[model samples]
Target: MAQNDTFNALLLQEGDPRPIAEVSTLNPADLPAGEVLVAVEHSGLNYKDAMILNGLGRLVREYPHVPGIDLAGTVTESSDARYRPGDHVLLTGWHVGERYWGGFAEYARVHGDWLTPMPDTLDARGAMIVGTAGFTAMLAIEALEHGEITPGTGEILVTGASGGVGNLAIALLAALGYRVVAATGRPENARHLEALGARSIVPRGELAERPDRPLLSERWAGVIDSVGGDTLAHALAETQARGVVAACGLAGGAGLTTTVIPFLLRGIRLQGIDSVQYPATDRERVWQRIGDLLPTEVLERCLAKEVGLSQLPQRAEALLAGQIRGRVLVTPTDH
Candidate 1:
C-alpha cells in the first residue's frame, strides 16, 4: 500500500531447486497480466502445493513462482465486465499457480474466467480453509452420488483420510449419514479422523499391494480416494458389488494394477476425480453443495495449523512425511 514498500511472499526459484520462503516484497506494477487483480487474504496448502515448493514434481514449470493453487480475496481492480472493485471472489485450478503467479503473494492477478464469487456463506479465511482440496472432495462426492451412491448402500471408504481432501470427504459423507471408514498411513492420525466422524480408521499398509484375489470381501459402497497406487486397486477389489471409488491423488503411486473381476463381474466403478478445468456450471454446483453440507465448526476444526508463507519449507516436508493432520492454511498477506 506504500511506495517502495513491498509485501512479503514465499518465492520458489526453479534453478535453486530449494524453496527460499523468506520475507520478500512485491510491487503491484510487476504483477502478471490478468483481467482482475485481487488483494489475497488467505491461501491453503495442498499436496500439490507441497510438490511445487519442494520441486519434487514438475508443477511450477517456472522460476521465482508463487506456488499457491487456491486463494480467496476481494477484488481491488477489475478490467472485466464480470467483476468490479469491492467484489469478493475465489479461484482454484486452471493453471493459475503453475503457469502464472499465484496467491502465495499478497496480490494475485488472475484471469476473469478462473475466478468465482465468494459465496455469502464463506468469508476469505473460510474460503481458503475449504480451498481446492475441499472443493475436490465435494467433486468426488458428487461423482459418487451421480453414480447412485447413497447412505443406504453401505459404508464408504476414504483413502488418505488425514489429507485435506480425505478429511473433508470423511466429514461430508458422515454428515450425510453414510458410514465412513478412513484410511491413513499415519496411525497417529486415527484420533483426528475419528473426531471428524470417521466411523473407523485403519492403517494404510493393509491396502498397499495388489489383492491376492481379483475380488475380495465386499466392504464399501463408495470410496473417496486421494491415494492412487495399489491402494486404489485394492479399494476397487474390496469394494462391494456395484460400488464406486472416486480416485483422485497419486500419493502412494500412480500405477494401478488390477483385473476386470471387480468391474465386469462385480459391477464396481473406479471413478476418476479431476478438479482442474471443470465446467463452470459443475464448479458452481459443487461450491453450492459445499456451502450447504460443510458446517462452520467442522471446517474450523479441520484446520490443523496456520503458517506464514516463510514457513512453507518445513510445512512441505511435514506433509510429504505424513507427519501432519487436518488442513493447513497459509496466510500470505495477513499476520
Candidate 2:
C-alpha cells in the first residue's frame, strides 16, 4: 500500500531523439530495491547526467529510467541500521544514474552503502551544489597531495576549467594556496573562473590540439584534468618532473594520444580519478574537507542555474551543447 504512493519524478523513456525525460508521478515500489529511501531535496546535473538525459551514451540500458547522478536529501526510511529517518545524506557515483534508478525524483531508494552522512556544516542544498563534480575535484586534490604535489610545487593546471569539476577544482586548489591556471575554451568565462580563484587563464585551444612532440617544456607541477583525450596528452607532456595528473573526465575526448616519455623520463604520475565506488570512509573524509575548504559563499557562486524537474530537459540539451557553465541544481519538488 505504501509502495503504491505516488510522487513526481523526471522519467526518462527510450525514444527516437534519444532518452526522453518528462515529469511523471512514480510509485515508491517502482524504485529499485535498496536499503534506504530518501526524500530527495536536491539533485545536480553533471556531464554524465546530461549524457543519460540525452541518451548520448546509452548510459541507461532500460526505458523509463530516472537519471540523476548526484543527490542530497533526508532519509525517510532505512533497512540498514547505519541510517534512519531524519538523517541527511548525499549520494554520488556508484553507477547510480546509469545502472540504477536515480535521484531525478522527489524520492530515491538506494543502497545504504552508497550514502554518505552529510557533514554538519553542509545542508542538503549546499551538498547538492557541490554534488558529484566537487566531490570528484576533492578526490583529485587528495590524489595530488598524496602524490607529494604540494601547493608550492608549482602552478596547477586545471583543464576544462569552466565545467563543474574544473570550477570546483579551481576553488578548492586556490583555497588550499595553489596557483591555478584554468584552461578554458571560453575566454569569455575568464573573469568568472578567476572569481572562483584561478590565478590565471589559458586558452583551452592551447591544450586541445595534439602537440607534435611527446613532451614539451615543463609548465605545471600538477594538474586536475577533466577534459581528457588530446588535452590529457598535452597536460602529460607539459607537467614538471614527478608531477601528478589526476584524470577525471572525457569531456573533450576519451583517447589519450601520448608516449611513455612523460612517465619514464619525467616520472610523471597519471592518476585516474574515479568518484564512483570511492570508499565510504574516504568519501566522508573528502566531504568533510570539502565543507571545510569550500565556504558557503564559494559554493553558492559555483551554482550557475537552479531548475525544477520540468526544466531539466532544456538544461540537459544546453549542457550537451556546451552552452551552460558551472553547476546546475535540479529541484524536483519545485516542479
Candidate 3:
C-alpha cells in the first residue's frame, strides 16, 4: 500500500444541496483499518444504496464516502485465519454502505467476520448480481418455508416483481415448484416476469390503492412483499388462512394503514426480514442456497445492465425514481 499506488472509487463529497458522487483516485493505505482487504470487482445497486448515493436518507454518516451495500471479489490481504490473499469472498448488509466505508471502489477493507466465502459456482459478477436484494429474497423464502408454507399449499404473490428481490423471489420459488403470481407496475415486463416463472401478473396500483375493508377476499396463500405500506396491507388482508407474508422493503412507503383483523381472524402472519444482522451461520446457509437455486440463465435475465463506478450517480437517480428494472451491477475497474 504505497502512497503512490492509486485505485478508483466513487467518492461522495458534501455539497450545499446534496452529496455528490465523483470518480476519484485513492491509496489502499487510506482504507479503514480492518483484518481483510478485498479487491472489489463488482457491487450491486439497491434502494438503500440509491438513498445513500443521492443523500436522500441520512444513510451515510460521513462525507467522502463510498456507497455500495453489496460487493464480491478476491481478498488481497487478510490477517484473520478464516481468510487469506486470493480468497474469493462477498459481503452484504452489516451497514457497510450506510455507516462504514463501502464497496463502490476498487478496494474495500472489512472485518473478516463480515466476509462470506463466495459460492463456488458463481463468479464475482454473478454473486454481485444476486447481491443484497437477492440475499434478502432467499431469506424471505426461507422464512416462508419455516412458517410451513409449502409449494403446493397455494399461490405466492410477489409484489414489486420487476425489481431485484421480487424477480429473484419469483425465480427461486418457481424453481422450488411453487406457483407464483407477480405484481408489478410495469406491464411491459409481464413477459419477463412470466419467463421467470410467474403464472400471472397483477398491476401494482391495484394493491397500492387502499382497500375499503380490513379483510379482502382470500386469494394469496402467501406473499413475498418488497413494497410496504398500502401494498403490504392489501396483501395481508387478501392472504388465506394460515398464510405467511415476508415483508422486506419499503419502496412504496413506510406507513401501514391496516387493522389487526387479518392477523386475529385469518391467522395470517407477517414476517419481517432483516438481512443486516442475520447470523453468520445462517448467512452462509442462505448464500449457499442462493448459489444452488439461481441458475445462470435466470441470473442473466435479472441483469438490467452492467455499469462502472462513474455511471453510478445517474443510475442511482433512476433507481430512486422507479425508472430502472431488475439489478444493476457496478464494475469498479471499468474504463
lDDT of 2 at 132: 93
lDDT of 3 by residue, 180-265 (tens): 99999999999999999999999998898878999999999899999999999999999999999999999999999999999999
Clashing pairs in 1: none
Candidate achieving higher TM-score, 1 or 3: 3
Worst 10 residues of 1 by lDDT: 14-23
lDDT of 2 by residue, 1-335 (tens): 28768999999888987876789988877888999999999999999988887778667888778889999999999989999899999999899989998888999999999999999889999899899999999999999999999988999999988889998999999999999999999899999999999989999888888889988999999999998999999899999999999999999888888899999999999999989889877788889999999889999989999999999888988987777889999899999
Report lDDT per candidate: 0.84, 0.91, 0.90
Give the residue spans of candidate 2 off by over 4 A.
Answer: none
Quote the lDDT for 241 in model 2. Answer: 98
Tens-place lDDT digits, model 1, residues 12-120: 7656655555557778766778899888889988888888777776776667777788988889888999999899998999977888888887888889999988887
Better candidate number, 1 or 2, judged by TM-score: 2
